[model samples]
Target: MRIFDPHIHMTSRTTDDYGRMAAAGVRAVVEPAFWLGQPRTNPGSFTDYFDSLVGWEPFRAAQFGIRHFATIALNPKEANDPRCRPVLELIPRYLDKDSVVAVGEIGYDAMTPEEDEAFSVQLALAVEYELPALVHTPHRDKAQGVKRTLDVVRESGISSGRVVVDHLNEVTVGEVHDTGCWMGFSIYPDTKMSPPRMVEILRAHGLERVLVNSAADWGKSDPLLTRRTGEAMLEAGFSEDDVDRVLWRNPVEFYGQSGRLDLSETADTGPLFEGSSILRGGS
Candidate 1:
């Protein structure tokens, strides 16, 4: 089964993980700009991080035959840091890049005032860039986070169709479903919803604009969760087309709206991009 994970933080993962994902039938992925698993001290840090996403990361994924794309934003967790807030100013430059598919991993983290400001600002960026937004709903008070996230998106002047509210669960899926935006679920081991639960949601809700991802990153997340979800769907009697729609086509339909998703071009047969090559001077 072909796969396209809409929100995995590959920056924290290894090249081995990339090989494993490609071997597992992952043809493409989007690595949203997110907190670096630790506080970033300044905007320069964000600048370099953004450079790597647009430069180094895509080159890395391509070597393993995976099409990589990224989203740019000041993540909610760091929005509260006065020092890190200037990263907002640096976002616009990166949005214009071809590899940047959306403005994302942006939404409430702690639901603080700073997070609110950053979220509102980046939504405008998504509108200006004419790209889709991949929103990360909070891990706690999830229902309220989704509610507030919808309110911000509704007021952002960007159409709900251009937004994907991610990290959704059973309790939060109902509200996100009611909205016209796309629904995203992260299937993980201990943190987010499980594959069986995700299947149940699909059974109860039906798949239209739904996207499922491993969200594999620095945690104990599995990069093969997309394949596992597809397997569960088949075991539960969903046809190949049904599995294909959720794991692959649905993500294409959503992120493709950006006009920057080029999985074909992304799979070019070449050495890594110059100076960004992971295959040089090493074993």
Candidate 2:
């Protein structure tokens, strides 16, 4: 079955990973601008990161026949740093880029006041641009964090339906779902949520406006997580139609709102990275 991994960090992965994903049925992915697994010392780092997301990464994915898209934001974990302001300033300039589909991977991290400020500001930006948002809730006090995310969305005056509350688990899924926002599940290897538990969650909650992703990045995570989830769904007695809606159709329908969903056309774009090796007849 064709699949779309709505969340992943291709910048931290290799072209080989992309090739394997394409071979496994993943046709598209959305990579959000997030903390680089370390503190970025300057705003220029953020600028370069955003540039790669809009430029190099998309070019790289096209070669593997995987459609690439992104969301731009100042992540919550970086909000506490005084140097983050300049990076935040750069976000507005690129939000309108053709490949940028949302205004997030932004929301509370430690539930700090600084996180609140960044979250509110980005929400306003989403409202001004009329773009959907991808919100990341905190790992601790998660239920409260999800509630706070919903509160901020309502206060920003953007429709709740336009927000996707991500990284949800059983402890927080009901609150996220009840908030009228779309729900996203990240099927990480050993930390976030396991594939087996994710299947149970889907069985209990029933797929309505739900999305599943790998959220893979510069970490010990699996890049082919969507496929793993699909395999699990099939084993759990879920029909192909049900699995398709969660893995493929839901993300397309969500990110399609940005006017940037074009995976169907990218399959003809050729290998993920051309002329980079002897395989492509390079010098």
Candidate 3:
């Protein structure tokens, strides 16, 4: 029951969460650039954030023996802010870094014209950089959002197989099934698909290109939901190999398109990332 959480927000999580995830069999994760709950005022904020994604987060995950990779983008919510739009120019710098596996969390938030432009532009960047994409469909009007998402993906000229439309439920999974793109589901404690529900999706869809994640963030989410979902699959009579394909191999195949995923065991280093330590009082 090894797991690769294809979409999670570990930047907002605690060091304890990392230990728990590793114990739950989560060996790897991809954290996509997303909104900070509040609006970011300038591109400099994103610069620092992106730096930590490639730098500090990986160091922290390594302490728990988890390999952390990141995706870079100017997220949909902030794309509407004139001051933050400059972050677009800054993304290419991170995209070239080895740790960046994709360009992502880029898609419609409010579905404004501003979101439309940012989505199109970043999808173009993914094409140019030869990285995969992790797209976030709007939380509201999900069915319509997925339809529009597939439409924009079609126009971007990037291979559909390289894109993942995430945060989907039963209502929207079929929309992406035959599109040549991968489907993603976030198993949450509440307000999203639960373990039993996700098992049903896998049962119906047959786990060819499906990715299940915990998507834990700075909210009431659970980092172990990925593990819990795997348990549910077994209880529902899915073979161990079937569980492996959804939780592990599917994400490997999707993000592997980047040619940058390094699943090598991350060696634990001295307690410091740029003079900062995950320890207190030099423990």
Candidate 4:
């Protein structure tokens, strides 16, 4: 079955992961800007990271025949840092670029006042830029975090149809479901929702506005979990179309609001980016 991982971090992944994902039927992915494990020192650090998201990372994904797109934002964890705040100004320019499909990873880490301001401003940016948004709920106190998130989203004036509240689980799913915003679950190997758990969610919640992703990054995450979740759906007796709606069509409908998702056959990006290949000694 074809898949479109609506949220993943290929920037922290290896080329081998891309090859595996492509072989698993992942033809496209949207990598939202997020915190690196190491704290960034300044806006320039984010500038370089954003550049790579729109530049080097896409080039790398193309090598494995995956079409890559990005979301631009000052991630929630870094929004609290005074030095990284200027990256907000840099985001609008990137949002104007063709590869940027949304403004996101923009919600709460600690749910501090600083995070609140950043979240509101970036949601406003999404509204102004006419793009979709990807909201991240705080890992702790998640139910409350999602509650406050939907509150902020309501105040932001962006339509619920244009936003996705991600990293949701059984406890938090119903909260987002009634709000008319898309619900996103990150299928992880251990820490977050697992494949069988995600299948049960689909069974209970039905398929509309549900997006399943790997959210795989620089952690103990697996990039193939999206594929694994799809397999579990089939084993649970979900029709192929049911699997497609959650794993593919839902994301397409949400991000497609940006008018930037290009699922058109992955373009031929050739073998080299800036005269360098993803190889030692140019292979």
Candidate 5:
């Protein structure tokens, strides 16, 4: 059961984490630039974060035989801090870099006006670059957040096929699916959706144009979540084809549209590293 975790924050993980992910059958991952556990105080931090996402992280994944790719964006939670504007301004310069597949993990959090502003700006960037957009909906007021995300997508005019609405649970899944955009589920440990409930969503949604990920970061989360979800699906009586479609095919089809997912032509060797950490060079 080869899989592709369409969402993850590999920057927060270790090389041994990558090895465990590969051993668990993860073939590739799409890591979106997001808020670190702590708030970044300067634009320089954000620049370094983006640099690592495209540089060392891919090198580390390669070492474990897992292909690495990323989506670049200004996370919603950080949008409120006026200090983040300069970093947001720098997004366009790197949006088209080799491993960047989308402008993403950008949407609403707490449904704040600042989040809306940042989301709108990044959504336009995705349209301008003709790349797919991965949206992160709110954990609170989820229904309204999902609706607001859809409205922005429609207004951005980036085709629905190019937008992925992530972090959906049962409450908002139907609405996200109804919007004609790709649906994403993050199977987390205590918060967000769990593996048992994920199987229930799969049972209801039927695995078409859907993706599953760990969204694993510095917080308490598991990098092998995709495998656990797959295991749950198997226990729930899903066929291998069903598992492949949701876990592998859908994400590949979505990110492959970015023209960066060509693992076939690239060498299978894992990415390079610095010490135990994946090192993305300083700008």
Candidate 6:
């Protein structure tokens, strides 16, 4: 089935990952602006990073026949850094770009005041821009964070349907699913949801606004997890249409709220750098 990973960090992955994703039937992906491990010291750093997401990364994905889209935001983790907080002012400009389908990976990280400010401001920007949001629920103290997250979202006046509460699990899914927002599951190898576990959630949740993503990055993650989850769904007695809805259609419906989700390929596509090769030599 054709798949769309609604959240991934293609900035940290190689061209090979794109090729593999294309091979595995991943036709489109959304890479959210996230903390790049090292603390960024200034807003200019965010500018450059955002440029690459809209510029270089999409070009790279196109070479592999995969459409690339991005979500722009000052990630919650970086909001706590005093020097990095100025990037919040830079976000509005990126939000106006065509490929920016959402204001995302934005939510509580440490549940700090700084994170709260960034989350609120960005959510407001999403409202002003008429864009959807991809909210990243905190990994630690997650249950508490999820409640605080939904509370803030309620106060933001942004429609819950326009918000996607990501990185959800069994414990948190019930609450997040209760909200009108879309639910996101980040499948990983040893931690977070596994492919089988994702199928289990689909069994329990019934796959309405559910989104499954690999969330692969510099960590020990698998970029093919979306494909694996689809395969598992088929194994778990999910029909082809069921797999299609969760893996592909769900992301489309959520991000399509932007009125900016472009899956069509442009003229700017074909082989790798300097005309090297991702193709095999012999038939």
179 in model 5: Cα distance from truth in Å?
Answer: 1.0
Residue pairs with backbone atoms closer than 3 Å in model 4 (clashes): none
Model 1 spans > 4 angstroms off: 266-282
Q: Could you give candidate 4's per-residue lDDT for residues 159-196 as a string of tens digits?
A: 99999999999999997999999999999999889999
Counting clashing residue pairs in each candidate, in order, gives 0, 4, 0, 0, 6, 0
lDDT, model 6, position 212: 96
- Residue 102 of model 3, lDDT score: 94
Which digits, one per residue and each the tens of the lDDT, describe model 5 over residues 4-77?
Answer: 89999988887778877876788789999989889988889999889999887887787666778999988998
Clashes by residue pair, model 5: 59-271, 59-272, 62-270, 62-271, 63-270, 63-271
Provide the TM-score for each candidate, comma-separated: 0.94, 0.94, 0.95, 0.95, 0.92, 0.94
User: What C-alpha lDDT, on a 0 to 100 scale, does residue 32 get in candidate 5?
Assistant: 96
Of the pair 1 and 3, which is ahead by lDDT?
A: 3
- lDDT (tens digit, per residue) of candidate 2 on 1-283: 7788989999999878987887788778899999988898789989899999999898888776678999999999988898876777899999989889999989999988888889999999988887899999888888888888888888889888888999999888888777789999999989889889999999999988898999999999998888899889999999999988999889988988777666657553333434343234443
Q: Top lDDT: which candidate number?
A: 4
Local error of candidate 5 at 104, Å?
Answer: 1.1
**Better model by TM-score, 1 or 4?**
4
Candidate 3: residue 43 lDDT (0-100): 89
Q: Which scores greater on lDDT, model 1 or model 5?
A: 1
**Which of candidates 2 and 3 reaches a greater TM-score?**
3
The residue pairs found clashing in candidate 6 are none
Per-residue lDDT over 61-146 for candidate 3, one digit per residue giving the tens place of the 0 to 100 score: 87777889999999999999999988889898899999899999999988999999999999999999999999999899888989
* lDDT, candidate 6, at 130: 97
> Hey, what RMSD does candidate 3 come out at?
3.4
Q: Global CA lDDT of candidate 4, please?
A: 0.90
